[model samples]
Target: MKQMQIYAFDMNCVSHINHGMWTHPRDTSLQYTDLDYWVDFARTAERGKLDGIFLADVVGVYDVYKGSAAPVIETGAQIPVNDPLMPISAMAYATRHLGFGVTANTTYEAPYLLARRMSTLDHLTKGRIGWNIVTGYLDSAARAMGFEKLPEHDARYDAAEEYLEILYKLWEGSWDDDAVLADRARAIFADASKVRAVRHNGTYYKMEGIHLAQPSPQRTPLLFQAGSSARGQDFAARHAECVFIATPNPQAARPIVGALRCKAEAFGRGANALRVLGLITIVVGRSEKEARDKLEDYRRHASVEASLAHYSASTGVDFSKYSLDEPIEQRSTNANQSALAAITKEASKPVTLRGIIDQMVLGSRMRPIVGSAEQVADRLAEWVSDAGVDGFNLARTVAPESLRDFVDLVVPVLQERRLFKADYAEGPLRQKLFGGRGRLPSSHPAAAFRT
Candidate 1:
């Protein structure tokens, strides 16, 4: 079997995917403000031979439940989040081969400015940066940005399509590969004739100038998308190099993954071009009993209120209004459609507030693997084969401890079974992932814009 790629999933905040876990005595998430915390985390991931660290982000507070932010603020449910891009350079400096995928929403940001920011990071990191594109899903975020209300769900995706086009023009089309001629004696940094301006007047954005920065290591950063809705899937099929998915079971994911791959192929991309990675949380230890005990201990710290706040914000449904035994009504909402779909279509049965809270006991709905090293490795292999997924994005249940356990226990077993790499590869993030140096594949749309 081919070695499975693993991304240590995290966010620059006290609370990320697993909300309210900051109260866990063993969790060091509260130290997110310290630069050394992230740098140390990056180095640890590199030592474990993990593929990268994927940092998730959100531009707004979780204010949907009861139309207020107090619940989230009180629980620290992803509130007081720091900027993900700020500490990435420091982390890059600490590790040689760990890739960084930082999420930035396109809805509120200007395309030109975001393009410059990503390019600058690409240059500084020597091409270890990737961007996870997201459209804002919170009405509070839109209102905070001075918009009257959030755009419709499908409309947001439409705007994103145009947003990406403008970025591609700036990143891939503005400068030629040979445009930069750094001959000190000649004193010519670039050939003006080779560099051209890109002009586009679209429904969502308008740009009329050359790209601001010189081409970085990868003209276009590796594209990642986490959209599972119909429109969202269409956007991913057109542009995403890697698609992030969260499913409750492999049986549930099979149809969705198949549909996505088929859609990408229909859009003229090879089936393998879009790598799919499912979210996972593992609790592995030296023995099965030890793993179970660890999980039980972690459960005691999980905050039910914090989980409800997060769920309410993500689905645009206030759980406070419904009884614990009340079945959550399936309806279309302006929030994250993928999240809503997961609860309704992917779950075994209709979800109630009680069921949601029960699942939240460990913070997230991702299935946890609790066993010895060999047992954990066997289950991971089963997931890879049965789900047809390329890899797993391991979510942190407790700060460095969750990662430490996996590295110390499961990694060795995976290595012994020849299912995980034992050392770093020799180049930029793209080169390490795809076995080539610099930029995207020729078949990718971004390549067409290259000068």
Candidate 2:
């Protein structure tokens, strides 16, 4: 029996992946600004023994459609977003077991600054932190950062490679494990000789300093990346411990999962070095009929315009300019390459404006699973077996109610089938997830930086 991991995929805003279902009466996403909401959510996820709550974020608005942010703003799509890092400490305090995977873009934030923040959180959470690495694709973000245009797709990753190497030097190399000695007589907090400055001069970044904070449980937070393009997968293969893929079905996921593992093996990380998680949304209930009814009810609040606006930003193609049956031009842009390829070159069927709208009827490209707990479990087990993924990242539909239902209703069935854990394992996030040491293993490239 293969065990599966699960994460509650969400954002620090009213609308995330599902587009426009926040208007549902039971949805509590509107209260995202409230500390209580996040704290409570962490508690709930912990109670259900969820592995983690993966928080997605963006630095810019979805302004691609009609070249304006009006539609997204009007629908309250994802514009009113807050910082994903803000609620993490509060959430960690509220729960002992739930891990946090927060998205932070490498393109916009400095490696030196990010390493300290992640180390601080790992210390606070007792090593319950993971970083979802992303490079910005939004022109709006570039504009905000004083750049006239975004860097080319592959060039961003090139810079990221250097960014990561710098982080590795700071996080893994700067401090020796035995440097800290709380010798009462000597009164030495840290051995000055054992700690050294990490200096680097590269094409993309330069830094000369010792790490500000001592090493946390995981000297480096668990690395995660969602890049399905050839270049993106190569980057993920070289760095990510966990890779996220959003495919329509298990079949579509199979080859990508294989590629990720194969690439990891080529890098000498072994085939099991990476855990792949497929993006999914489930609306499970006590019975099949009840689940179907709930899906219909939730579908009533779907915001097609908001979904299109979000998709436009994702693919860097304005759906507003195309007619219903007009073919979408799959032009290369600084945006997400996989997002564009998924609907154009790699699509299972001919994709057009009409097809895109049809897919978004349920909010995003993914089709939600509506079934009894047993049926849902069966589907998930099949997903693991056929897709070769280790788990699924559950996207939210109606906020707390949707997650609450899955935890209360579907978890037990999966547990019974031995597909999900009955309780969390002991240790820091890395130890719990992959077992063994809390720090990067010697085989990992980051370990090369270790003294």
Candidate 3:
């Protein structure tokens, strides 16, 4: 039996994937700006022996729903968001083993600058950091950046390939592992001859500079990608150490998981090279009835309008124009093709305005698992076996409350069943997760850049 890897999925805002849940009396997402909140979150995750805390981010507002950002602002749906990178150092200081997988969009960032920032964080976190690489889909972000429109869906992925290649050169190639000598006897701080400047003259970018920072514990932080699109999966296959997927259920997850692994195999990566995590939300209680009751309580605060607003920006379609019974049309867009497909073309049934609302059971497409500790554990085990996923990026429901319950109740059941580790492994995140060296494997594409 393979032990499952779990990450606490959250965002630095009131409403993340589960929109409108901030209104719940128990929810304290408003404290997102406070460093203590993230520090506490990191501590709790470490206590639960979770693999990491995945912090998601969006560079733009959800204004596509009704031709305005009012609905999103009124409902507090992923708007008023903060930078995910800010709280990381404080959180890293508070926890020992809990990794931090921070989402950063390559669509807007400069490769050299981003590489330096990640390397700095990697040094500070002592190698318990991972990058969730993303090519953003928000037109609002593009407009704010002075672009008339975002690059086409496949075009963005195309640039991302070049972007990551430059990052590999900066992180892995520029600095030799032993560039820092610190030779006090010889009065020399570093071997300048060992460090080389990275030169990239690619289709998307041009750079000729040395990496600002020295090699950290894991020079290239663990790469995590969540591109469910076809081209996206191809990108993940080549570079992603961990792949995140948001599907309706275990059945929906299997094929996507298989596709990514198959693509990875074609790239000459080993079978276990990529760890795929399906997104899920769990509502745990001491009794089955208690969980159901909690589910009802949570649902009462959920806002469908907020979900629509968020979805509009995601799929590049305004849901306000559609009638209740009208079938939503899926068209080619520069936005998240995978997100739109999940509710439209790929759905088991023809999705309508009403169907869209119904599918958002708790203000999210990710339906929650309501059960006792034993039941939650059972569902998780079944997902791993039936879906063929490594584990889940458990969506945060009632903030620290749901996570607290999971660690206290569900973790024990999982450990008893031999489905989860009772203790964490030693070393950097990559080694802890894969049980080997703390850096990219020799077969990995990034390794080719190494000196």
Name the candidate, 2 or 3, with the larger lDDT value: 3
Runs off by more than 4 Å, candidate 3: none
Give the per-residue lDDT digits (tens) of candidate 1, residues 236-305: 9889988888887787677778988998888888888788888888888888999889888888887778
Q: What is the C-alpha lDDT of each candidate?
A: 0.87, 0.91, 0.91
lDDT of 2 by residue, 1-451 (tens): 6799899999999999887788888888999999999998888889889999999999888899999999999998888999999999999999998999999999999899999999999999999999999998999999998888899999999999999999999889899998888789988899989899999999999889989999788989999999999999999999999899999889999999999999999999988989899999999989999999999999999988999999899999998999999888778766888999988888767689998888775777778988999999989988999999999899999979888999999999988878899999999998988999777777789999999
CA RMSD per model (angstroms): 1.3, 1.0, 0.9
Clashing pairs in 1: none
198-281: candidate 3 lDDT, tens digit per residue: 998978999999999999999999999999989999999999999999887899899999999899999999768999998999
User: Which segments of model 2 are wrong by more than 4 Å?
Assistant: none
Off by over 4 Å in 1: 345-348
lDDT of 1: 0.87
